[model samples]
Target: MTGRFAYGLRVHGLDRVTDLMPAPPGDDLPEVTIRQHTGPRPVPEPLDRWRQVRLLADGRHLAVDRRSGTATFHGPPLTPDLLAHPYLAAPAVVVNRWTGRETFHAGTFVRHGRAFAVLGSRTAGKSSLLAALAARDVPVLADDVAVVHDGGVFAGPRCIDLRQPVPGLALPGRTAREGSRTRVSLPPVATHVPLAGWIFLSWGPGPALARLPAADALGRLAAERSWPQLPSDPAVLLTLAALPAWELTRPREWGALEATCRLVESAAEAAAGQPA
Candidate 1:
């Protein structure tokens, strides 16, 4: 099936059905074709200086051609969850990077028609926080990678991967084991919302929010960027830095999640000029 993903990418040749909808009418988005290889995986070769063939942990072989905008997957049969993630999501980001779009290793949620990107380290509970927000009726745009272009955050796959089930948080749709994490599928919600601000996650004694200076925010964002080895567009980073940012520190306790969610929602609402 063909579907549209973040960064205006029309991905074709997906083996399993996905919640990702087709592009809106008359919208011209870049196309990336996925072709399944049934034979032995080819000897991996670099597509270019920027693209290389990769073998995922699950024995999936991925190869991307930047010039032609195509990704070839070969290996064991893929489940729906795997296809949506490393297969489709990985290439989509690569295509976006090739086209000069900026992507961050962050989660994003929508509040009051604006998006706030939650930036954090790998174990910083970014996905956990997003799952918590999802449970609270907040619209999560993307879980792991938030694509930014022209100051708008693109909607990502309709799912979130969690290390384990969050207590008292139940999401609808398929639930399955994806490696070490549980993949919770969500309903389709494609929205490209204007980014309102950034929220950096940190651990502290209690829940606290502090506004970050532009310089400080810039450094944190840079550290959480996807494909940092590649050159970044200074203009894009500068523009994002200009947005309102805060360091959200909270006690690392599951019991603190409720208060943490409230803080995030309030901050997002406040940024959107809505009464918190």
Candidate 2:
């Protein structure tokens, strides 16, 4: 209630304190809800912007109204990541899309004064590299979702989901019961920093970063599956057009995170020289 988390919106029921920045507060009832499911059939297509309720056979129900900034969820009794829609990127993306903002599945950090992020496949080591950067004093802006507003970026929670113990970073106060992976925590980013650079991560390419054309960056940024479904094609495309992007490859060998961090930092600096 006192601090914020995802989407920078003040949240209720998140009493346990972590270093993550709190979302902005609102005096309304929780805009999100997840609990035991009740019987409700899938909603058929209706007028534009009408509430769309999707019911799954697994006793789950999801309803959204982007125009109204409302979302409702009902899941099976034991679902651990209850606020998956919000804590994750989908719901927030929906709202952002409605508001003409673009979104991406990426992890962002601040260098000097500007912010930069890495967009890539889920297993592309975004979190691990970000962990290494944070350990070295780079402030993490958003863990998974990067909300692109104009040419800038808004950070999400400071927490990240880690598969194994991050050596240099401290993972404190376990959050959700994410299976196999442990939810990692770090101090919240105090403010949203302007995005100066970004990189696309992949497995095969060299760990070196190469500049990319706008066409390529647009296509790749839109293609990642881990990112939420694009709500408006026009808005997302516009955001992509305004940002500079590059392709960054992950090293095949072990223990290259530190080296990669240095390489990416160089890339961010190089990008800052170009017009956004």
Candidate 3:
């Protein structure tokens, strides 16, 4: 059975059709194709591109596409058992012919400039921090997983993400036309930045900023990572682990903005090899 999505979504990874296309053997990587369709029927026009976002706790999402005849697993720490696991058999989205395997679990995000990412738990002020950085004209890198490759972070999709700010704070020019979820760009930014420090953030009733030891910051960031089980390249992980990380408690009313600016500036400087 071809596992196509009910929506007329012709974009890659959004529907079940493209999810199931055949791939080269021994390598479990998706040969993605973005095409257009009309109400489950393939459209002659070029397919518009879009992105699919998945938030996994413990890494467990299965996808299958019938039109292309493919199946895949999106949860973290891709394992051999992922092939036969019952949970991996069912997914939030499914296509037919495509099949691939990823040893790592990564959430998707489109790029803006250097692929910057914020790793933190829910309510940890990740989105707010990113918005603040955008306000400072740093460019929205990725609100979630900022996938990093050899030399730069990968931008695979461009989407618009508009969601609510942290509980108490209100974002300027926020619109309710769409749901609470932010609209991310579809065509991802291809620009790659040299590996920069991954910043870790925290908030509290009182305002204070402290530069955490590199080790401590890495540990904290590690805990907040999306997938801890994936067997990733040791060198890449090591480099990320060695890079500096920051932990800043939320600042008081007017102080929050200043603190955010300082933190971003510090990160930029660190990335640029300037004194912080």
Provide the clashing-pair count of each candidate structure: 0, 12, 45
TM-score, predicted candidate 2 vs. hidden true structure? 0.78
Clashes of 1: 0
- Per-candidate Cα lDDT values, in order, are 0.80, 0.62, 0.40
User: In model 2, what lDDT does residue 175 have?
Assistant: 44
RMSD of 1: 2.5
Give me the overall lDDT of model 3.
Answer: 0.40
* Position 2, candidate 3: lDDT: 22
- For TM-score, the strongest prediction is 1
- Candidate order (lDDT): 1, 2, 3
- In the range 1-276, model 3's lDDT, one tens digit per residue, is 121111111223333322122222332232333322222222122211122223334433323344453334443334222221212322312221112111111222222233434556655666556555555555554444444545455332222234554333334432222344543222223333444555555666544445557667555655554334323344555566676555556653545765665656666575556677
What TM-score does candidate 1 reach?
0.89
lDDT of 1 by residue, 222-263 (tens): 998886755688988998999999999998889999999999
What ordering of candidates by TM-score runs from best to worst? 1, 2, 3
1-276: candidate 2 lDDT, tens digit per residue? 464456534433343434345555555422432223445544634424445555444455556664454555555443434353233355565555555666777888887678887887778878788877877777888778887775678777666666666665544635464465566666756555777867788776456777888887767776752324335565657556557788887665546667788887777766667322
Worst 10 residues of 3 by lDDT: 96-105
> What lDDT is reached at residue 107 by model 1?
88
